[model samples]
Target: MKATIPVYDICTVSDGHQHPDLLTERLGSYLKENYQRVHQQHGHSFYHLVLFTGGSGSHTLDFTRYAVEPWQLYFMTPGQVHSWHLGPETEGYVVHFSTAFFRSFLANPDYLDRFPFFSGQSPDQVMEVPEKLRDAIQSVFEQILQAGADNEPDLVRALLLQLFLETDRHIARDGEPGVPQQKQLVLRNFMALINRHYRSLRLPREYAEQLYITPNHLNALCQDLLGKTAGEIIRERVLLEAKRLLTNEQKTVAEIAGELNFPDNSYFSRFFRKYVGQSPEEFRKSLN
Candidate 1:
């Protein structure tokens, strides 16, 4: 069976107020309670930005695990899997939005260049949301909440825009321009290509050809900035998606192998085991 990219919808919360939107407030409550209850819970689909204002927790985010503490922020991008083990009496605010929300903003050609935060940087790029900044975020959420229920869409859009701006502010305060401007652009384009076509294109040279550069050059840049060879990066991306489909959805191994463009089920199984240390079926069973 040929594999198909599953259809999934982006989740958004809209309100027409200037105060903290009800959705954020409600989600914050749920996160506070659940973070405490399930020593750990896995997130599927939508991206979440969680601000840990109090208490502590352990979070394994996208192959990297970290301890969550007060005044710290963590970002979970769409398609990245995460499991969190909450500390006792955790308190925080969580903002959930879909890729659709980001698309509306990134439709502008210069958006990604202006904001490097979306670029796949190390997870440690997260910074503390300062006290004044937190107050401002609270104000925006509160405004959205206060707005009468009549204009939900407008309120939600406003709050989302404010949130994005606040995130940019935090990034600006914390991020050091470690990568050169030209290299950053190259790396950004490389990531965009992989994110869109990782299933079909498996070789670093393929990406190099598309970028009009030598494979050796591309590997050099990737190693210098991302600390990984081009092949390693590509494999990581492919395996990440494979894991998502196998565990989150009811897809058969043969179907997934076909979608990933393997020549045969046996080849795909061997490839998966080589990188993941287990067969696809074994990994899926472990998730269950």
Candidate 2:
């Protein structure tokens, strides 16, 4: 049998949604029905953000574990892998939304991408809500919950944006040194490119050529904002996908190599060993 990961959409988790684009609910109620799946490794077809006002456990996103603590907020873009453990008393607010959620409401379709937490990088996806701002953020989530119950998509959308804006203001506040808008734009484009073409175009120069920038300039942009060279970013993406596939036990190592378009299984094994510090089979065994 071919192994695959579970990828959920709005309807799969909830029903009777007049607004199919967004769903907000108390995390406890959600867990009452979804506890099993929530603990299993899976991906979502929509953006998922949760604020833990009261929780004790952990959330694992793309293989990185984050402690579940009060006032912690986590974000996930579409297609990212996530799972969690929870205490019986765990409670919070969770909002699941689709790309279409804001595209119709705002003039800019990519506006949500501007927020750092929504970047889907595991490190950037988890955050501790600032000490003083916890109450206000909690209130905003309450408002969103009420709006969601009323099936008011517009209000829900606006409040979500407000929540993001308020959180980003304080969270990224260390004067985030006003990176040039152009540089930010380029970085976003580069990341998008990497996601779209990492399997085939593994070279930074190839991306630079597409962006009409030199390889050095591309590396500088990545280094300045992301603390990694452009090439490393591309390789990280490839490795992430490889790991995701490896999580599916039915797939053989050579099959994964072929799926990733590696020239041969030996080359793929070498690459995995060089970075992952173990053979693919060893990694799979560790998971077991």
For model 1, the local distance difference test gives 0.64
Candidate with the greatest lDDT versus the true structure: 2
What digit string (tens of lDDT, one per residue) describes model 2 on residues 1-288? 545768899778766656777888999998998988899888888999899889699889998888899988888998788899999899999899887778878987777766767766777778888889988999999999999999988999889889888877776422155777688678877876777788899999999999999999999888988789998898888888888788887788999999888999999999999999998988877754
Question: How does each model score on lDDT?
Answer: 0.64, 0.84
TM-score of 1: 0.73
| Residue 250 shift from truth in candidate 2, angstroms | 4.1
Off by over 4 Å in 1: 1-22, 26-28, 32-44, 102-106, 109-175
State in Å the error of residue 21, model 1: 12
Which regions of candidate 2 fall more than 4 Å away from where they truly are?
Answer: 1-3, 16-18, 172-175, 178-183
lDDT at position 208, candidate 1: 98
Q: What is the Cα root-mean-square deviation between model 1 and the actual structure?
A: 5.4
